[model samples]
Target: MTLFETFAAHVDHALDALVAAGTLPAGLDRSNVTVEPPRDAAHGDLSTNAAMVLAKAAGTNPRALAEALSAELAKIDNVTAVEIAGPGFLNLRLHATAWLDELRAIGQSGDDYGRSASGAGKVVNIEYVSANPTGPMHMGHCRGAVVGDALASLLEFSGYKVIREYYINDAGGQVDTLARSAHLRYREALGESIEIPEGLYPGDYLIPVGQRLAEHYGDRYVAAPESEWLVLFRKAAVADMMEMIKADLALLGIHHDLFSSEAELHEAGKAEAAEAELRARGLIYDGELEKPKGKEIEDWEPVTLPLFRSTQFGDDQDRPIKKSNGSWTYFGADLAYHYQKSQNVDAMVDIWGADHAGTVKRIKAAVNALTGGKVQFDIKLVQMVRLLRGGEPIKMSKRSGSFVTLADMIEEVGKDVVRFTMLTRKSDAQMDFDFAKVVEASKDNPVFYVQYAHARIQSTLRKAEGEGLGLDATQLSLLGDAEIALIREAANFPRIVESAGKASEPHRIAFYLSDLAAAFHAYWNLGNDQPDKRFILAHNPALTGARLFLAANIGQVIRNGLRLMGVEAANSM
Candidate 1:
């Protein structure tokens, strides 16, 4: 139904003719022989590397095959010209009218124009922003959160059943520290001069927790032992911080379907359940760990510890499951948590930061050991993001981290810029997020440029009202050269989105929008040189209707592209 599909089918028929003439094999696989927009527009409207890739497989010279194929393609009416370029690439220029029909298709479809069904009914879980509840989310976590959320939206649009989840690290020594910190606040609320010493949290955010404790208990636990209030204070602070974190996520338009708690797992003895499973396979045992190569402690000696045989499944060395103090190491809980995911989800993807790269092998080894290579666990690492303002880097303290929270950034630059810029690069590559650069209303900034296209079309429609255009489907099919070019660019949306969803890379959506924006801007600028090319045809009512249809098509593409990136396509700037 798409213009590309029609072009491709013609190419297939030409290839079939070549086969019938005995110039090519009768049953050659033509799936990889694609008719697509060329990287170099000067080459042609479309190009195919069919000969280059199939030459060796087919035992034929590439240029000779392309020459033979081009001769057959010259018969199609809409194909204006065919040229065999360097290394046997087939370049095609389509008749101007073909593009006009594409405009009609897009305009008639509107918002539904580029909706893809590539994912069908597949289920996928995207787990991201599993930051600890100990503090507020900094700029470091914001990029991945936005990227994951946008990617989920993109996949859903392409027809995937997606579940967005967050893992809550609410169990362990960190909560104890939080409790102690709250106790200090509690005493301070009672008018006690309690110094927030080196070991406890000193942030003013938790002062209210102390106030609430004072208001509820009224000095009941002031003289009581540490045990009574530690549990109560820890629970309250953790719950409040989690709520704050959730609110912060909401500011950026993100929500998780499930919030799996670490404390719940511990309280339910899931770690013990995992340990029992490992013990049955003889993977859990008491062992002595190797001392560090350069940093040995004063009492450095091998100590009996509960260890997991991670080396058997590809880790560098066996890893500790329990520490010398008889407490589980942080990695122990991760093993149980991941092992549980391996059982629950059909397939799993873990989004983590670059610092977690060092731990990937051991984690993978544990999954292999736990599930015996049955379930595949893919770990995607999101690299560091350096937030900049007018090209100046912002330094943030690790303790305070950043005051530029997710909410702060969204309130500043908006959700569309936040999502699109985050996906401008591969997840593993380090990215520079500049506040001054993204807000620029130029082609260099994809968000504004794309939005401008939509606004321009709406403005053109307003101008066309005086030109006697109907703004209906009957008027849309009468498109000219610039109009057709815009429609062909828009038609690429569905295909580009399907490619992005299958690749699990939302950056493709950003890239495609950039290209589409370039096409739209160029077409719109052409009106300055030619009066007829202008969207409003003052002397011709039928032609004006056709141009109005083209303008509507441009708006449709912009809306579809923005929807995929979780951005808005505004009718006006």
Candidate 2:
């Protein structure tokens, strides 16, 4: 158990003892109590709210309850001091031996030090970067891709059985347009001049698709009518586009375990089955939806269409499932997809762009009704990333064939920089990703700062090895207050990992890394002015070995934290 866990168990034991001694009522709920690091390190090592939370239920004032709890907690080994602070908060000061033991645990566990079973093997499905399979992924898709992938890694580290999924939106009109564009390219490949008219894909990306078509079938599809070749071209176009998409994702080190196709959903009648199920449950009906928001209502026809009673579950209005022409709407396929996903996982999360903000409520309502509230679902909306270079907005990319593609960004700044920079901000907040600042090797750049700390420690270990020094734990108790402060920061890794995974926020890991790195850098700077503070003291072998042990564990934690963020821990600057 971690130090926090050990202390929390002690608190619970003290509470149970209080009940046995008739000092408190039996069966008092203690779930509200929390043991955590004190905000101000000067206050204590750890603080608990047991007294504050249980005072009323115990029929005693908070101060009196705290005094009583402190008396019992003071007897626990390693708990050197327990003081009652504001409003009966119990601040604890553990001995340096306690932190030494934690350092020893870190050395023993190495990479597995911060891994947790908090998720308890619950099945989780995360769908991200579900970009349309018509073209390469743009910068608009980068933030969600990085965030989703990092969150998946975080959950897996916390013991979740994660299924990374990608939903291919191939059953829409976009793929048909893609086919027409490919056919135009095919005609061009057959030596006929073609103007990619307005409303068609004008990017040269389709040139290869057309060339391949010409190579395979020669002039058969070149002169064929749209009806004779639309399906074949659409199939080939989607397949080829998906290959390109996969390559782009691979550039960022993202690989999904499942690629669910919307066309397959329609082909397998899953959408129809989902609609029939909802209709049987009286959640589906034939109705007319309000006119499109922000559009003129004069041209809107008041015709009846198939609708789902999404408003019953907190949406603003009922949503259309099928058009008046009997074609399934996009939401219809989405319902089936989510239903199929819910059948496989205990929880599901969809990472979407902020442009889909208006659809969140209805989709949530649909999932609620379909699963009868049995499945846990969440939607993380990632705001747009404003790419910048040298303080100016970057506007275009030749590779994207439109805006900047993810591959373009990856190629320019590298995968580590792109991933780390995107995760430096929260998902809901818009960020200006300055190219000059992210790659700058300065303290202002968090990625570089954290990586430098890891690299510096590695360099220290290498130097110690050259000097023929061995790490010694017997002299760990010789560590001073400054060393303990660094250990305290390192000890918070497991707690931070657990909290980050629980909240489904990978940005927390990035932020924590910056803070931990700052602490390590501050400690390193102290050695410059004071010879006694250095990790390698030639005159004091035992002290040097103890400090090296501490540094090694801190580097291990840096490596572990970096792994969680999908960033590499550099061994050299």
Candidate 3:
């Protein structure tokens, strides 16, 4: 039901007819041929590169091929005219009913109109928002979460079976520190005015965790050694933090299908097994690293450590899997974790924040080597978010207890606004999240703009029903320029869905929605200025039913797109 997809197929059919008539060579590789909107809309409704693409292969001049193709295409039913533009471009202008039929397709398929089978139902694993479980997610995590979730939805709609996952770093030094910090909270709960010393978490969020630990253990760990209570306290602290994280994600209506914990991976011997497998493949060996560039930690040195031969697989240099202190490095655990994770899926995707940009190459190299280059691992880096309100920046952080949580933001501006706003920009580009502007129901706010389009459609349909006109798909196929423009945008939805999946960019959906909404709004305003263009006709039932059908198709497209982005298409403004 995708307009571009159908147009391409139709063009191919026309070309096939030409080949059968001996106008074109048989067995031509038509894969490179494409049908797209002309750069200048006035030039034609659609333009194709078939003639240009085939010119060299068919041993003919581009203009000659275009002329021949144009002649063949001119006889098609929908094509009103076919012309050879400069450089052999074939511009095809279709009859108005061709666009009207496109409206019928949108009305028929509704939101499913844009669904594509580009992924071939392949399995895709998307790992995003691995925010350490150290604190509430910040501005940086928002983009990745939205991008990853929307990308997952896009892939699913495009025929991929997607698994959305989150990685938990519970087995790292940070959690050990959390255990110690919680022990402090546990002590403070026992009536001791404890001072949070250096290298300890100072955020007020730990206060409740401290109280919970105290209530559960009742000063039992107050006099215990760090060793005696570290494990228990770490478990409690990590659990509490993860609970907060879940609630935070819930604010955005996000829930991962799987949460793979680093601790669990180690506990289940996954890391050990992965490392052993790599070693067996001769991909692991002992080596002294070329002393790290920039500032080096005093504890790190060019000592003999277990290293992964990442250089063999296109990494910058071989990386140390084990630290000089004989403990496995974070990268080491990640490699094994990735290896274990890969065993379960056809492919792997890691969505990390901007700070993790440098880590992509090595991890991808490791996964490539460990999986015998059978699986492709991609890392999508979501850039940081700059929070602004009315032109000034919002300097806030949940980590330092200075800013609003995702929960607070949701409470302030409902989930739909939050979801749409987060996805309004590319994940790799820094986005300005303006608090004041986001809530405003206006053209500037994309969420409101799209919602307004849907709301207007609902009102139009109600008015049509009052006129006693049946506004179903069959009755809605009749469309004029405004209606055809809206339907043409809708017909291209599936194409956008597939493109977004292929590019791993969900922001495209947000932009596409913006475009669709604009088209619908233009149609709406035309009714206000020109009553003849209005969807409802009080005196003419047939025309009223036809316009009503246009409104319904647009409403369906908006609703379907909003659902994919986890936003709502409200019937009322």
Candidate 4:
């Protein structure tokens, strides 16, 4: 247990004692009570709002209850002082030995210092980078890919059985366009003049796919009509495009456990079955949708369509499942996909681009109705990324159909920089990815700052070991308040990981790592002014060993946190 958990347990014990003594009411709801660090470090090490929360239920003043609880909590181990702050807030101060014990625990736990079983082996399916199998991945899909992959890693670190998935959109009309484009390239490869008319992909990336087709068929399909070769070419083009997409994802160190194809879902009759199930549940109906507000629909006619009662699950209106031409709408296949996903996992997460914002409510409604509210589903919409170089907007590349491909960015900056920079902001917030700032070796670059801290610790450990410093006889009692403050900051890693995992936000790991690095950097700067503050002191071997122990544990934590973020902790600059 962490220091916070230990203190929380003590608080619970105090509450139990009060109830047993008839000093407080039994069966009080204490879920809202929290023991955490105070806003200002000068206030105390940890603060709790137990008294303020329970006072009204017990029919007593907050301060009166605070005093009683404080009296009971003072007897807990390692609690050196307990003071009642404003409005019955209880601030706690622990003995310095408590921090020493925590440092020892960090050393003993090693890489497992922050691992938690909060998820309890619950299977979580995270689908991301579901780009259409038509072209290369662009910068639009970059953030969602990194966010989803890192979130899966974070959940796995927190004891979740994570299934990283990618939904291949090969069943859409876009693949037909890709096939036609590839046919144009194949005709050109076979010594025929071809023009890529408007609305067809004109990127050079598909030239290889076209060459492969020409080499295999030797102009056999070149003279055939669209109906004779469209399906065969579409299948081959989608296969080659998926291979390119997989290679692009590999550039960013992402590999999904499952690649679910929409075409396969349709082929298996899952969509029809799902619709039948929903209709049996009275959720599917043939009805006319209300006119959309604030927009003009040309030739707006009331056509009866199969609809899902999405409004019953808090959506704005019922959703359409099929079109007037007897074709399944995109939402129809999506419902089947989510239903199929719900069968294998307790929870599901979809990482989508911000353009899909309007579809979130309906998709969530579909999942809820399909699983009878037994499956948990969430969608994270990643906003756009503005690529810049030295404050100037980077234009799209003509090499990939006027959109900057993720490969372009990865080629400019390495994969680690790309992945780390994308995660520095939350999913919903738009960010400017300045190439100059990302690669800058300054504190302005969070990735560099954090990695530099780890590198510095590595160099220090090498020096300490060269001086014959051993951890066997280190005296932790020699640590003072400054060292204790650093230790306390390091001890917050487990709490940060658990909280980030629960919230499904991997960006929290980035932010927490930056803070922890700042603390370590600040402490390292103190050694410059006073030689006694250094990690290595020739005159005091025991003190040096103890500080080195702290440094090693700090490095361990940096490694662990970076592992969760899918980043490597650098050993050298």
Candidate 5:
């Protein structure tokens, strides 16, 4: 157990003791009780809200309950003192041995130090970067991809069975445009001069698909009517584009466990099945939707369609599952897609772009109605990222086919830089990715600061090994207040992993690592003015060994954190 968890159990025992003495009522609700570090270090080592949470149920004020709880908590072996502050908060100080034991635990656990079982094997399916198959992966999809991928790793570390999924939007009209574009390129490859029309994809990335088609089919479909070859060309072009998309994602070290196709979902009648079930339950019906909100339409008309009762679940209006022409709408297909995902998982998470924020409520409502609220569902909307260079905006236009591709970004700044920089901000906040600032190699750059700390630790361990000063016979008691403070910071990794996983925010890991790195750097700088504080002392091998052991474990924590972000910790900078 972590230091926080260990003390939580102690608090539980203390509460039970209060019940045994009839000082507090039995079976009071304690779920709101929390044990965490005090906000200020001057307060104490650990803080708990047990007294304030249960005082009302026990027929006592918060202060009296805190006073009674403090006496029992004082009996813990490592608890040095318990202080009551504010209304009823209990802050407990621990002996240095508590942190020393945790430092040793870090050494013992290594890469597995921060892992937890908080998720308890619950299966969670995360769908992210489900971009349309009409173009290459761009900066538009980068943030959500990295966020979802890191979240998957974090949840897995917290013991959740996670499924990484990508939804291919191949059943839309955009794919037909891609098909026509590919046909144009196919004719170009067959020695015919062609111009890309305004509505078709114009990027040179599709040039190879046309050449391959020309080689395989050799003029068979070059002059055929649109009906004779639209499906065939759409299939081929989507297959090629998907290959390109996967390759681009690989550059950022992202790979999905499943690639679900929208076309396949329709072909298998999943949408029809979902509609039938919801209609049978009175959650869907044939109705006419109101006119578009906040807009004046010269030729607006109401038409009857099968609509899902999304308004009952907090949507602004009832959503249409199918249009009057009998084809499924995007919401209709997406609703079925989520239903298919819910069949095999206990929960589902969707990482979507902020542009799709308007549809979140309806989709959530559909999922709730389909599952009868039995399944846990969450949708995270990631805001846009503006690429910049030296504080100036770098403009891009996807329609003009001049936008920056994921491959180009990865090739320029490297995958580690791209992945780490993408997560430095909250997913919902707009961020500027300045190419110059991200690779600045200064403390202002979190990626560099964290990696530099790891590299420094590895270099120190190497020097210690060269000097034949091993960590085998070290005494942790030699670690004084300064070293113990560093240990205190390092020991929060497990708590961080659990909290970040529970909150579904992987950026918290990046923020925590930055804090830990700053602590280690401050501790490292202490050796410059004080000769005895340095890690390497030729006169005293014992002290050097203890410090080296501490440094080694801090490096281990850094490695574990960087692994979740999919960034490599540099051994030397």
Candidate 6:
């Protein structure tokens, strides 16, 4: 158990003693009680709201209950002081030995120190970077890709069975356009000059696909009609495009466990089955949708279609599942896709771009109805990142096929920099990816700053080794107040991991590492002006050993935090 958890149990025991002594009533709900670090370091080491949370249930005033509780808490082994302040909040101060013991625990656990079992029995399916398989991945998809991948790792570290998934949108009109474009390339490959017309893929990336088709079947489909080769060409082009997409994702170290296909889902009648199930439940029916709001459409006409009663689940209006032409709409396919995912996992999370924010309510409603509210679902909308160099915007246009590709970005700044920088902001906030700022070797760059701290620790250990000094057995009580403060900050790793996992926020890990790195750097600067604060004293081997042990464990915690972010802790910057 962590120090906070241990004290929580102690508080519970104290509450039980109060009940036995008839000082307070039994059977109080303590679910809302929380034990955490005080907001102000000067307040105390740890703080809890047990008294404030249980006062009303116990039929007593908060201060009165707190006074009784503090008496019982003062008996805890490592608790040196307990004080009540500001309407019965309990602030605790523990002995320096308690933090020293925690440092020892960090050394013993190493990489496994912050791992938790909170999600032991749960299975999560995270689908991310479901970009259309039309072209290479662009900077638009980078944020969601990094956020989802890091979130998956965080959940797994919290002991979840995670299934990383990707949904291929191949049953749309875009793939047909891709086929026509590939056919043009194929004709060009077979000794015929061709020009790519507007509204077709114009990127040279498809040139190889056309060349391969020409090599395989000389001129059979070159002069044939569109009907004769559309299906065959669409199939071949989607396969090649998927290969390209996977390679681009690999540059960022992302790999999915499953690739679900929309075409296959329709082929297997999954959407039809979903409609039938909803209809049987009286959640789907044939109806005419209300006229869309805003400027009138000259061609608008009321047509009856199969609709899902999403309005009953908090949507603005009922949504159609099938068009008047009897083909499934995009929402219909997505509903079926989520149903398929729900059958296997206890929870599901979708990472999508902020452009799709309007669709979140309807999809969530569909999942709730399909799963009878048994499955947990969340959708994270990531904002777009603006690319810049030295504070000036870098122009890109997807329509002109001149956007910055993910491969190019990774090549320019490296995978680690891209991954870490993508997480330095919240998922739904606008960010500027400045080429000059991200790679700068200064404290303003979080990735470089945190990695430099770990590197500094490694350098010190190497220096100690060369001087015939190494980590040895020593008295941890020799550590001063400054060293204990560092350990106090490092010991919060497990709590940070648990909270981040529960909130489905991987950016918290990045924020915590930046803070811990700052604290370590502050402590390192103290040694320069004070000889007694240095890690190696040459005259005091025991003190040096103790300090080295502390430094090594701080480095371990940094490494563990960086691993969760899918970043490497640099040994040398």
Candidate lDDT scores, in order, read 0.79, 0.90, 0.82, 0.90, 0.92, 0.92
Compose the digit string of candidate 4's lDDT tens values, residues 1-573.
877788889999999999998989999899989998888888888999999999998999999999999999999988889999999999998999888888988888888989988889999999999988888888878899999999999999889999999999888888999999999999999988888898888998889989999999888988899999999899999999999999999988999999999999999988998999899999999999887778898988899999999888778888889888987899998999999989979999999999999999988988888999999999998998998889999777543488778888889888888888888999889999998999999998998999999999999888878888756325899988889999999999998888888888999989988999999999999999988898888898889888888888999999999988888889998
Model 1 agreement with the true structure over 1-573: per-residue lDDT tens digits: 677778888878887787788878777777678878888867778888877876777789999999998888889888899999998999999887677667777766777776667677566678899987876676789777877887788778877778888998888887888888888888889999987777667777778888988998889888889988888888888888888889888877788998999888888787888888888889889899988778758888789987888788677778998889976788888888887767755556678998998788887777677888776667778998998999999777534433567777888998778877888888899899899999997777877887887888887787677554657556555665566666767778877877777677778887887788788778778878877777676687777777677677777787787787777877788
Q: Which candidate model has the greater lDDT, 3 or 6?
A: 6
Model 1, residue 413: distance off in Å is: 3.2
Q: Write the per-residue lDDT of candidate 5 for residues 431-486, one digit (tens) a residue.
A: 99998999999999999999999999999989889989877425878889999999
Worst 10 residues of 3 by lDDT: 472-481
Clashing pairs in 4: none
Q: Of models 3 and 6, which has the larger TM-score?
A: 6
Off by over 4 Å in 2: 57-60, 291-296, 397-400
Show the colliding residue pairs in model 1: none
Candidate 3 has a TM-score of 0.93
Q: What is the lDDT, from 0 to 100, of the residue 255 in candidate 6? A: 96
lDDT of 3: 0.82
lDDT of 1 at 404: 66
Summarize candidate 2's per-residue lDDT along 1-573 as a digit string, tens digits: 888888889999998888888888999889889999988988999999999999998889999999989998999999999999998999999999999999999999999988988889999999999998878888878899999999999999999999999999998999999999899999999899998777788888899999999999899977678999999999999999999999999999999999999999889888888898899899999888777888577767888988999888778888888887888888888899998889878889999999988889889888888888888999998998988889999886533366777788888889988888888988999899998999999999998999999999999999999998878988998899999999999999998998888888999989989999999999999989998899998899999999999999999999998888888889998
- What's the TM-score of each model vs. the native? 0.87, 0.96, 0.93, 0.96, 0.98, 0.98
